[model samples]
Target: MSAEIPAWLALESGLVMQGRAVGAEGEKGGDLVFNTAMSGYHEILTDPSYAGQVVLMTYPQIGNYGVVDEDAESARAWPEAFVMREMSSIHSNHRATSSLPAWLKEQGIVAIDGIDTRELTKHVRERGSLRCVVSTTDGDTTSLVAKAKATPSTDGRDLASVVTTGAPYTWAEGYHESYPHELGRAFDGAGTKGGGERIRVVAYDFGIKRNILRSLVHCGFDVTVVPAGTPADDALAHDPQAIFLSNGPGDPAAVSSGIAAVSDLIGKRPIFGICLGHQILSIVLGAKTSKMPFGHHGANHPVRDLQTGKIEITSQNHSFAVETDSLPDHLELTHLNLNDHTVEGMRHKTEKVMSVQYHPEAAPGPLDAGHLFSRFREFVAG
Candidate 1:
């Protein structure tokens, strides 16, 4: 083992912290945000929704179980940099193919460890997420702070397009587990619960996660994924039974093309969206959205269903949310976050359109909200 290299983290607030370099040797900067999930660091790292940001795991000890190929949420890591209190060198897991730091280095993601993540997270909580820089190449605090201050924000950028798939593709794979036999569509038979013809769905890939596609297939939808820039007419050409808008990164208002596409497809098909998709859908429904103070980015958020009076713990990752006062009369509120009273879910009063601000796929979160996929299936059946 070579001697550990020193790294520095500088926030736009002029605060600087020193740590040990764990991943690639270089410099990177972005909006510094934190995730509270204790596990699923792999999923968080590969999640395209983390694009244009630096992720700080609130969990004190990360990488104990190591990295596995099957756990990746996307093809490549999306966070500009990774920050954690401790990056465990010894990893032991039956499915792991490589250690976390090794995998980060392989993916060319710059990372730092041994920093006081609790202090950093508290800073973000009190001051909101800030632009920051992480570097192993630069040891000067003044230089790193200057770079952090100069880092571009994701406020108005179309980051989804930066991570979206370039071409259309078909997905048939399902969840790897068989214990939950009712909700999984394996390669063999028609694994749908009802044993009927699968409903066709056109899913807009605005930085989609693989687990979402698997969840859709598991719920008996034949999914055809298209680029974020795909037009409504082109999507309608697929002759889908429903349309899905996926979770993504950055300001939803900046995704003007996606908003227009969803606007045209509103009444043509039953539509469902999550995260960035939820914001865009709300925007099309005459609702306004604004960036949250610190934003919600965790797996343990509690949401109450207005109709059922049930609270569901959900996985969420977003910086902007739909404004409650801006909700139009044509839409009805379906879910609200118990923590901060933010809009968690909603649906059209007449049209077959619905959306949620959290991840029901539960890649790195709980399975309490997985029924939303089935609910979408019900919308298609109706």
Candidate 2:
């Protein structure tokens, strides 16, 4: 085997772990968090919400399938650094166009493997997600620790701006890649039964994932994704049948302006939100949010849908959650996490507004909850 390249990850709390660099050779800094998903490393790497963050995967043996263009959650990789337990030396999947290490190198992302991720994850869970620095070139552990300490936390950061697209864009058409035979046989109930009038949906891009957009498109919506800071009036100008708020990073309270915009658009249009978007929506609805001790960052979290009384295994990645008691009477809880009993979803009683704390797109997780997108389409179609 080649000589292991030296690298280290230092946290603001003065904790430092040494390992070998596997991707690009350089330095990276961000808030460090751990994800427990056993697969979909590509989607996790490309997820825009991971921007300005260093992700440590708890699952050992990563990169078994390699990377594929079709699995990317965004146009570019966003995670500042990646930490894994082990890196597969050889590519092993037919769908893989390139290996994970090669892809990370191409994207200029720093990564390290063969680390004790379980212990690291436990530390993060105990102390909370902290600012961290990853360095391949700098072996000075003391200075690296200082740098990590000097790094500002995600508290007031407008991370959404850093990840959102500069311009609006559209995605593939139709609710499915191909029409299902069951839908074909079912009678069309709404306008234009034959083809059905496509719902016009506008999504406020606060670090949106490609899978979310794809899910929207799959639900028979013509999706128009705008920038994170796009004004409510500008969104209204689109005359969209419904509005969507996407998942993102950092504190929801920090994005006060976006919350105001969501508040203004509440009764004016049908709305749906997820992750950070869900927190913002809660704030708009006069609800409060609090940071979790460890935060949910995995694909196997279970949430119970209060409306349907069904349990769904979900993909979650956020550090904050909406306070269930703080929700106004106008809004009602729609789902709750089975593990911690936190509010996982909510919906406005009068307005066509709904949100979920977990990802329904399921890029690196289960697709059982994808029906939420169809519900949004139905709300817009009305």
Candidate 3:
């Protein structure tokens, strides 16, 4: 808690930056990545897709509004470490039950404030995401760099399996009407207005977020969350009308189980995928996936719907992308990222299967893409 305590961050490329330290002590490291979102620090921290990654906030100041219970995307923080230009000393929101510093410490996440994040983000953008180390106990640049270099990269890693739910369960919670709107463990709805003839959906929990489940429930789907490697027969045993693949961390190409499982599930029922799910679906659709030079991780990414030519401001987070050349004839591309002209959404021409490479349930982001969930429901109804 004193400014006298030294902290240092070291990149695999031999770049080192000094800063003030907070949260859990000792050294922590992960695949260094940056987010451009101005807010949603809590949601970003809790998102399971950030597992095994060190996240740097592009926004100058963080923790100004503090952390609230409603905004977490998962049960616990998943980022190995957190970096910020300035961490607020005081948390002042009326609804905030937790201070960012105490919360990070409690979660066992190493955090550094006052780091030169601008230069670090620029480095990642230009050189691509590199392994990095954040040390609060040891400040020796040489040792930190060595540790950073020793850290394995996210490439070929199946991080989703590590963060996935150990057992299958039903999710009935719906939209959060709270002040901050983060999905809480409690269901506070008063009536059954969100209820109806619930369409049964088998959701593949590839590090799924709570908001995605909330969105599914809001759309009247009775969701059964299964593990990342759940096969078609096990899922079909529940007699679900639809199948869903969730967003997650790491390379989609490495998930041979997911790809194989999805390949068998397609055409059997209506299916939908998001982020890593999208990439896996693409792989099963005879497409290839490769790591992006600098992956998209932000609240505001523009994607154009091919069918309507309308632009949607979306929240995105992923390191791998679908190769345009790898798409098969049966798959029809539906959305494209306006910034990089990359694939965003696609669907099988014949089967009731569709996927998006961005988060439509956007827990910490916009409502522009929410209609995609409705479309999926319609797809299932048909």
Clash pairs, model 2 backbone: 175-218, 175-219
In order, the Cα lDDT scores of the candidates are 0.91, 0.84, 0.87
Model 1: per-residue Cα lDDT over 53-154, one tens digit each: 999999999999999898788989999999999999899998899999999999999999999999999999999879999999998989999999999989
TM-scores for every predicted model: 0.97, 0.93, 0.95
> Residue 115 in model 2: shift from native, Å?
0.8
Q: Is candidate 2 or 3 superior in TM-score?
A: 3
Task: Specify the poorest-scoring 10-residue window by lDDT in model 2.
Answer: 183-192
* Cα lDDT of model 2 by residue, 81-198, tens digit: 9998899988888778899889999999999987899888888888877889999988787899999988766777778888888987776643343323333222233323345667
Superposed Cα deviation of residue 88, candidate 1 (Å): 0.4
Query: Candidate 2 at residue 226, lDDT?
Result: 87
On lDDT, the candidate that comes out on top is: 1
Regions of candidate 3 where Cα sits further than 4 Å from its true position: 1-3, 179-196
Candidate 1 C-alpha error for residue 306, in Å: 0.9
Please write out the lDDT profile of model 3 over residues 27-137, one tens digit for every residue: 888899899999999999999999888999999989988888888898999988999999988878997988998899889999998898899999998898799999998
Record all residue pairs in model 1 with backbone atoms less than 3 Å apart, i.e. clashing: none
| Least accurate 10 contiguous residues by lDDT in model 1 | 182-191
